[model samples]
Target: MRIGLLTEGGYPYATGESALWCDRLVRGLAPHTFDVYALTGDAGQEPAGRLPLPPHVRAVRTAAPGDAEGGGPGGRSDRCGYGRRERGRFEAAFADLAYGVCAGDVDTGAGPHADPAERFAAGLYALAELARAHGGLPAALRSETAVRVLESACRASGARRTLAAATLPDQLAVVEQWERLLRPLSLDWYDASDGLGRVDLCHAASAGAAALPGLVAKRFFGTPLLVTEHGSRLRAHYLATAGAPFTTPVRALLAAFHGRLAGEAYRRADLLTPGNAHTRRWQERCGADPDRLRTVHPGMDAERFAETGEHEDSGDPATLAWIGRVEPAKDLVALLHAFAAIRRRQPDVRLRIIAAPVRDADAAGYLALCRSLAAQLFPAEAAGAHAAGESPVSFEELGSPEAPTLEDAYAAGAVVVLSSVAEGFPVGLVEAMFCARATVSTDVGAVVEVVGGTGLVVPPRNPTALADACLALLRDPGRRHRLGAAARARALELFTVEQNLAAYRGLYLELLSHAPVRHRAAPGVPFAHPAESHVPGSWADRPAAPATSAPVKATATTVAAAPGDPDA
Candidate 1:
């Protein structure tokens, strides 16, 4: 089947969310042709180029959100003002969105009859149609007309107090952001033959902006849409917009837009695959049909850690290891504090903070802060720490001599530690599981789901709970071994690439079975006739009266007139 893989700020890019796993999935399901429709974010991700793709990926069409603001020279989006009629259309569609958001008409758990969601979708698609017909929105959405519509909506009757109180600046800010998020609607990917219309299925690798193309494809071409969310898009929007220097009006507006979009995506998608049950619940709460939802855990390559996983003996008996990026969300400071508490109980134990290479300035600063905290907590001269220039807390890279590979990093610890205050799939935790290492993780995001009772989970940011959990695992070798074995078993059965591919392979065929066959030939779109192979009837059960009819064998004329013969 031809799959249109839709992604945002990831996949094909060297960085971004869902890139690695999506690559693994595309590589694994190589039999199917993929046409990637990727929307990159504001970071100029295209400059970084893309990851090497397998041959099955027929096309990789990458566009940045920046494209929405332009049409190059002599194009429709050349900062040319919309015509009077075009202005009317733009205003009406923009008003539907602004009014829906302003009045708080967004519904999280509503059916198709829900007017709020209906209006949101109607407005979204209307704008998409306008872009398709007019070449693109360009400056229309960022024009004064849009801001006027938003201001009018805020002051309209039944609008929320927070939105109604929005100032001019707030309206402008919201308009700018709204235009940014709506970039997908203005893209050239809406072409019927060369774009998403040609694909059999639209596999949206994410929701929100990434899924917008799939929504359009399904609407225009009857394309089957499959949306997969490793993390909840609406929830992420809420988290990102909170305390983000925006007024309540801006925040509420952003949240409402994302909520409405997510609800629409859930309602229209043929299937919704969340990476974990935690994400599944988020979707359900956001009005996704329970029947359409499926949980597909993120998959990793197990063979990378196979030798280490199967080994009976690996890693230091007295060490706890933390492996992941050094970000504030990872809560390295909390982990250091927890290690301080662990040192009080067992002075001989060591804590290793193995971080992936970080490029962001903020991440570098956060890493530096963690190192400083570790120093203050465990001074070099401290008697209880490891001897001979070794501190109790050590920060090292994954490829360093001491930890040559990811497996080596996991192997350096008897118990893997995850101290993130926020997480998605807990990939590192699963990697540790694959390496057959016992774990102590914070109970946040999908940590509990991934751990699944195999490892100890403590509340986030609680040094006491974290320290206690680590000590328990460290002190009991037999318990540690049992948990490690169980974790490895679970990771192998559920989190490996093979299992993930198998699940998607089945899901792909299942979706196609229900979808109408799409044809490229000139006979025109035909009936939705399904093969009746399963019906219990003589048609299915009867052996041929072939022997009776065999006497009427093919004559020369009949043979000449066979289906494939050119001449009769």
Candidate 2:
């Protein structure tokens, strides 16, 4: 089976969150071919410096978020502006989206007839058609004409109560943000030249902006889309919109837009795979059918932490180790308060905060705040020579002689502590599990789901609960050993690249089996194994059914004969 691995700011890019896992998955599934459709976020992720790919990857095509701004040359397939019929469809669909959002009629929940899903799908396809005719959607979605169209739609009958209450400015502000975010749908990536229309399945690494093109491919080419979200896209959007400088009404309107898009993705995708149950519930709430949803945990490199489990353990017996990017979300303030309690109960206890390598300026600020808090917490203890030498709490970067690697960081403590008030998946907890170390994590995001009773779960921002959990693990080495063993067992069983590949391999064949082969050759061309298959390691070496010829017109555009097409 051929798989179109769709990603945004990841995969082929050497510097994104999902790059390593995606590379591992593609490499593991040698039986299938992959074509990477990467939507990068910046120039730094240019394909020229992409990760080394395995032979199974046939091609790598990329378009950045920046591409939607029309910053470079005009798109290759641009036609003139839309004609009357297409323009009508675009106007109608755009109005439906605006009115649905404005009126609170956008249902981001499961129901037999959800208008948000319909609105998003209709608007998306309409935009796609418009982009195919015009250069792209930039001029159309943001134009004065577009805003006026939306207002007209809001006043139309069947519009929601919110629309009736909304002013013209509220409507325009919402439309502007929606247009900017939905730009991915207008790209030419789904055309015949791109492999998107041809693949047996389209697997998006995450939801949100990255998954937009996959939704388009599914709509335009009838591609079987499989959307996987490790972090809940809707939740992230809500958080971002809340903090954004936009007005409350604008945020509400954009939130409605995001909620609608997510619902559409869930409704349209053949299957939805969230990394954990926390995200799965979010998807379900956002209108994903329960039957089509599966929870597939993100795979990680277990081997990297194996050595830490075996040797060079965290030396302080009562020490609590925090490993991850030192961001405010990690809740270092809470960790410090908890550690203070631990210090008061047992003065010898130490706290080791492991900081991720800082390439981002924002991370530097977070680290500084953590350092000041740690100093204030232990001020008298570190007032004189101790401050200059060894402190009770210290911030350590990833690579140092004292804490050389991730393994070293894990081994340096008896308990791995995660105090983050906000989290997607506690990646640090998984790393600790790989190192065969016990963990104490605050209940947030997918923490309880990922840990799965393998560690101690405390309430978020509760220093007392956090301290008690760590102290329990510290005092009982036998309990610690048992938990560590179980954590490792769970990680190996469910969170390995091997397991991830197996799941997708099964899904690919399952989706294909439901659709009969629709790309058989012409009358005289035998459907037998081709000559290339006879080359030792190919399918000719394996047993096969006899050839029977019955031509089926390829309904999918990507079915056009490539170099190795069975029909050719």
Candidate 3:
């Protein structure tokens, strides 16, 4: 089967967990060919180039907003110069989006567009049709005309209080962002000859901008769409924009758009695979069909930690390890405070804050603050009598000689720790589990779900609970060993790349099985082409006779399967 994989700022173009998962997905599913439609989020990603791809990936088509993130705060816009009729069509369609955002909602409506979600979907597709018919919609979306329509909707009856409070500049800001989010509609990927339309299924990496194209493909060509997100996109947006400088009105408008888009995508998708129950709840709350949802945790490669798991008793009994990116969200400060409590209970116990490579611009500052706090909390001079100049707390990078590989990092600790206050899928926790190590993590995101009953989980941001949980495993070696063994078995059975591949491979075939089987060679069918069809030619009328006994010569009848045979 042919699969169209949709993504944003990940897969072949970037590194880290999201990209790694996408790469494995494409490579692991060797039976099905893939066509990747990637949307880059950063300018730097283009220069870095793509990761090595397997032969099964047939094509890679990419787009940046307007050549370079167009129509954003400081980016160029794709000008769609619409004449009179086109302008009217755009205005009418855009008005539905505005009304849906400002007023028409589940609670307030009684008409043809009673459901605000319906209004939102209608407007989104109408604009998409306009873009498809008239090239694109960047100029119109960023025009004074769009601003006027938004303002009028804000003042209309039944308009929400927050939206009505929006100022002119706020409207402009919202319009700028909307144009970027809707940029996928203007892409030429829906062509039947050699693009998304020809694929048997559309598999979106997430429900954000990546899934927009899938929605369009399903609408245009009846292709089945499957959206998977290890980290929920709506949750990320709410977290990022929480304390921004924008007023409530602008935030509300943007949020309304995001929510509606998410709901529409949820409603239209043939299946939705959220990474964990944490994410599944969010999708369910936003109106995803309960029957269509599945909780598929993103898998980790167990072989990466094979050596560490094999020698489970190698780590120092007194050491506790924390492994992940050194970002503010990880709450290293809280971890430091927890370690201070651990120190009071046992002076010889050590805490190692082993960070993965930092990516965010603010990570350096966060790491610096963590280092200073650790220094003040446990002065080296104070511990001179016991460990002889060792402060009992150490900071190291993953690639350092002491902890060179992933296995080395896991082997450095008797008890692995995760102190994140806001996590998504807990890749580090799963790594610890794969390495057969006992873990103590904060109760956030998918930590509870991923850890299951294998590891200890404490409430997030509570230093005392975190310290207590770590101390329990540190004091009892036998319990640690038992938990470690159980964790490894769970990881091997439930979270391997092999398991993920099996799940998705079945899902892809299942969707295709139910769909109307259209031949690639079927002429005059929409989105049908000769791309994957067998080359037509004349064949022998009858099967060749069997070779005579003792005759060693090659014959057509001796062949295992014939090329043009109907059964073959």
Candidate 4:
């Protein structure tokens, strides 16, 4: 099967949220071909180039969010050059879309037979079709006319009160953002011969703009779409726009747009796969059908940590280790306080913080703050003996002679600690499990689900609870040993690369079996029939039995059945 893998700021890129997992999936499923459609987030991401792609990847097409600004080679003219009829159609459709956004509830009742969701969907697709027909969306989408239309919609009756206070600047900001988010409508990737229509299944790595093309493919052609969300796109958008510089009305309008998009994507997808239960619940709240939702955990390589898992007894019993990118959401401050508490009880205990380098300047500032806090919490023991009895807290990075790799960092301590207040999948905790190290993680995101009773769980931002949990395992070697053993087993069973590949392989075939097959034959072909098996023996001439009651419907059982079965 050929898969169209759609992503934003990830996969093929050297850095991004879902880059590693997407790379692994493409590499693991070698029998299937992949065509990647990536929407890049920034200019810095392009300089790193892409990860080496496997042979199964047939093509990589990328577009940046800024591509809609009308300054590039394919950018449209500033005047729009719309005919009178086309201008009227554009005005009508844009008004409906903007009004739906300002109203705050895209599916709410405008009337008894209104169907607001259908209105939103109709307006969006109408604009997409218009853009396709005209070669691209007019630069008018980013013009003052667009902002004026948006302002009018905000002032319409039944609009939210928050939208009533929107000024010209706020309207302009919203229109600019909308242009970027709707850029997919101007792309030429919907053709049946060479674009998304050629794939058997369109798999969107996340929602919002990345899934926009997949949605278009399903709408223009009869392609099946599968959307996977490791982190809820709606939730991320809300968090990012919460305290942004935009006005309240602008924020509300942007939120409503993303919410409506997510709802539409959920409604149209043949299947929804969330990386964990935390993400699954978010999707459910956004109106995803429970029957279509499936939870698939991200995979990690267990073989890389095999040596550390086998020798769990080698780490220092009095040391606690924390490994991950240095960011404020990780709550490194809380971890330092918890460590101080642990030190008061056990003075000889040490903490090693192994941080991964990040591209964001804010994260670097956070790392510096963490270092200052560590120094303040643990004062140097006599200035001259800084090396002799150095502060028990030490910050290190990977690739140093002391800790060369992630596995080496996990091996430096008997218990791994995670104090993140906000998280997605707690990948670092899972990596600890892969190394057979007992963990003490705060209860956030999917940490509890991933741990599965194999390690200690404490509430977020509670220093006392975190310290106590770490102390409990530190004081009892037998309990730690048992937990570590169980964690290794669980990680190997459910969180390995092999299990992840099998789940997706099955899902791909299941979706394809139900989808209508596209005929790619030439126009002159008699029946437009694809090649079928032809046996050149006596059995080929035998008449087939024709009295079967009816064909059996395919179920999950039949779809997953082994080959060579009569029913198969």
Q: lDDT per model, in order?
A: 0.81, 0.75, 0.83, 0.82
RMSD of each: 7.4, 6.3, 8.0, 7.0
Report the candidate with higher lDDT, 2 versus 4.
4
Local accuracy of candidate 4 as per-residue lDDT tens digits, 1-568: 7799998888889775489999999999888889999888776777878999987798998887656435243433344457878777777777767876776553455453255556667778888888878766647586555777889988987788898898988887788778778888888788776788778899999878888899889999879999998888898899888878877878888898998899889989999999999999998987799999989888888999999999987799989999998888899999999989999998888888988866689988999899888878877532433868566888888767778998999999999999999888888888899899999999998888999999999999999999999999999999998999999999999898899889999999899889865534333334333322122334432233345533222223212222321111
Q: TM-score for every candidate vs. truth?
A: 0.87, 0.86, 0.89, 0.89
Error of 2 at 72 (Å): 7.1
Query: What lDDT score goes with residue 528 in model 1?
Result: 21
Q: In candidate 1, which residue pairs get closer than 3 Å at backbone N, Cα or C atoms, i.e. clash?
A: none
Those runs of model 3 whose alpha carbons end farther than 4 Å from true positions after fitting are 68-80, 107-109, 359-361, 380-389, 522-568
When sorted by lDDT, best at the front, the candidate numbers are 3, 4, 1, 2
For candidate 2, the C-alpha RMSD (Å) to the true structure equals 6.3
Model 2 stretches with alpha carbons more than 4 Å out: 68-80, 83-86, 106-116, 133-135, 154-173, 311-315, 385-388, 520-568
TM-score of 3: 0.89
lDDT of 1 by residue, 96-190 (tens): 77767666653545544236667678778888888888878757877788888889988987677788678999888887888778878888897
lDDT of 4 at 352: 89
Model 4 regions lying over 4 Å from their true place = 66-80, 106-113, 380-389, 522-568
Worst 10 residues of 1 by lDDT: 559-568
Name the better of 1 and 2 by TM-score.
Answer: 1
